[model samples]
Target: MERDFYTFCTAMKTLDIGSAEGRGMSPQNYATIRLALAACYGKLSKGRVGSSLELTSEQEEHRERKGRHYCGLKEKGKRKDHERICIPGVAAAALSAVVFARMRHSSLEVLLCGLSLFDVLVLSSTLLIYPAMNACQNEPDPTNSRVCHFFWRSTLIAYPLSLIAQAGSVWTCVAITFDRFIAVFFPIKKRVWATPHTSTYIICGVAFFSVLFKLPAFFEITLNEYGQITPSSLRLDATYQLVYMTYMYLIFILLIPWTVIIVLNGIVIQKVREAYRTHKRLTQRNTRGRRDTDERKMTVMTIVMTGIFVLCNIPPAINNIIESYAPQYRDRYRHRIPLSTLLVCVNSASNILIYCWFNRQFRRSVFRLCSSAAYKRRASEYIRASKEASMSQTLKNKL
Candidate 1:
C-alpha cells in the first residue's frame, strides 16, 4: 500500500509538470515555476512542509498568467504584413505616379510638392523589394500561427524611413502654414518669406533634419528569433520607452508641430476673414488677382491637409505614450497600433483627393493629364486619314 501511494503521487506530479509546459509559459517563467515546485517537493521530502507551502493569492495569480508580459501581446499570432505592404506600397505609389505625371500643372505647386515629397518617402520605405519578397516566402503554419511573421532585419530599414517621412510631412505642413501666415498677415514681406526659393530651402532642410533626428533608431534596432524586428529593448525598458514615447512622440510629434501649425493657420484664417469682411474697401484693381487666388486656394488645402494629418497620427502617439508609462494599458491598447498606422498610411495616400477637393486647378490638371493620351490618339488618326486622302487625290490626277 505504501509503494502504491508513492507511485500515485509521482504520477500526479508528472501530470502537473506536463500541464505547466502545455500552458505555453515563456521559458523564463517556466523555469522559475519549475524551481519553485522543486523547492516545495524538497521541503515535503524533508518533512518540514506544513500548510505554509500553500501559495498566496498573488503567487497564484502570477502562476496563472506567468508567460504574459503585457495584456494584448500574450498571443504571438500573425503579423500585419499584408496591410503594411498593400496600403502604403500600392496606394501611395499610384497616387504619387499621378502627382508626378502632372508636374507641369498646378498640382505641382509649392505646397502640393512638399506633400508629394512626403508621399514619395512613404512609398520608398513601404515598397522595398526585399521585405515584400520576405513576406511572400513566409510559410503559413497549420499550428502555432501568429498574426503574421515578419523579417525583423528588413524592418530595421523600414522603421527609420517611416519616422523620417512622418516628421518631414509634419514639418512641410508647418512650413506651408507659416508661408500662408506671412502672405495673409504681413503682405508686404510675403515675397521675402514665402518665395519659391525659400520653400525649396525649407523642404530640403526639413528632409535633412528629419533624417538626422531619426537616425538613432536605426542603430538601436534588433531582430528577434521569431523573425520580428523591433527596437533593441523590445519597447519595454523605461528609458527606451520614455525617450521615444514621452519625449519624441508627445513633444516632437504631437505637441510642437501641431501647435505651430494650429497657431499659424489660425492667424492666417483670421486675416483672410478680416480681408473678406472689407471686400468693398479692398481694391479690385490689384493686378495680382490670379496669384492671390491661387495662394488662397493653396492655403485652404494645406490647412485641411494638416487637420487630417493631426487626426490620423494622434492615436499612434497616444498609444505609444500609454505603452511607455502604464504597461497594463499597453496590453489593452497594443491591438490598436496597426489601425493607427493604417490611418497614417491612408492619410499619405489620400492627399491627391484633398488637393482635388480644395483646388480647382488640381482637378483641371488631372483632367488634362488623363485626356492628353486620348487627344494624341485622335490627332494621329486625323493625320493618317488626311495623308490617305492626299495620296488618293494624287493618284486620280495621274490617271
Candidate 2:
C-alpha cells in the first residue's frame, strides 16, 4: 500500500496540471485528471485531498531547512579557520607596529607606524572579540552568565571599532602612497609639506573620520534582555541599507580609497622607473647616485605595499558589491568569504616582510633594535650579579 501511494505521489508531481496546453492536454482533460488524482489521494490518505497536498509543501519546507542547516555548518567551519589565522596575523601586526615605531621619525615611517597599529586593532578584534562572541553564543544559558553578557557587549563595540581600524589602515596606505608620490613628483614640495608632523595630523584625521563614519554600525545590532543578539530597528530600514551601507560604505571605504591608491601608486611606479634610469646615468657621481638609490628603494617599498593592498582587497570588494546589488547570489559565493577575510589578515600581517625585503634602512633599524634590546637584557643581568656579589662580600666581612 505504501509503495503504491509513493508511486501515486510521484505521478501527481510529474503532471503539469497548471499548464495544460504545454503538457499536450485540453483544459477539460487537465481538470478531469486533477480531479482523478485528488480523489485517489483522498482515498489513499483517508483524509481531505488538501491535507495530501500539504504533505508536499511540508516536504519542501523540510528540504529548505536542511539546506540552511548545511550552509550554517559550512560557515561555522570557515569561521574556525578565520580564528586560527588571526592569532599569528595579530602578532605579526603588533611586531610590525613596534618596529615601525622605533625607526627614525619620518613621514614614511610615521605612516607605516599608523598602518601597522590600525592593522593590529583590526586583527586583534577578529582574534579576541569574535571568539569570545562565538563561545558566549554556544553557552546553554548565556543570559545567566555575566561573562557572556560582557562578551556580547564587547562584540557590539568591537564591530564598529574594527571597521574604523580597517578604514584607518586603508587610508594610511593611501597616505604612504601619496607621500611617495609627492617625493617622486615634487621633491622640493615634499620636503616642506610631507613632514612627520604632517603625517601625524593626517593619521589623526583619518582615524577621526573613520570613527565618525562607522558610528552607525554601533546601532545596527543589540543584545536583548533574553541575551539573544538581534538586529536593531535601524538595521531594518531600507534607507539605511541603501544609503549608509550600500552607497556610503561602498563609495568612501572601497571605491574612493582604491581609486586613489591605484592612481597614485601607478604614477609613483612610473616615476621611480624613470628616476632609476636617471640615477643609472648619474652613477659616476657616487654621492648623488647613492641618495637617489635610497629614494628609489623607499618608492619601491610604497609601491609594493599599495599593490598588496589592492590585490588583497579585491575579494572583499567583490563580496561587498555582490551583497549590495545581487544578494540572491550570496550563497553561491559564501565559501569564498572566509578566503577573502584571510587575505585581509595576510595583508595586515605582511608589511613587515615587505619592509625587510625592500628597505635596507628598515631592516638595519630592526636589527639594531633587536641588538639593543638584547644588550639591555645582558647589562641588567650583569648589574644584578655584581650587586649580589658585593652584598655577599659585605656580609662575610661583617661576620
Worst 10 residues of 2 by lDDT: 67-76
Give the per-residue lDDT digits (tens) of candidate 2, residues 114-201. 8888988888877656566545534434556666677767778787788888888888888888898888889889879899889889
The clash count for each model shown is 8, 0
lDDT, candidate 1, at 37: 47
What is the clash tally of candidate 2?
Answer: 0
Per-candidate RMSD, Å: 12.6, 12.5
lDDT (0-100) at residue 385 of candidate 1? 100
Give lDDT per model, in order.
0.63, 0.75
Residue 198, model 1: Cα distance from true site in angstroms: 1.6
- What is the Cα-based TM-score of model 1? 0.64
lDDT of 1 at 237: 71
lDDT of 1 at 393: 100
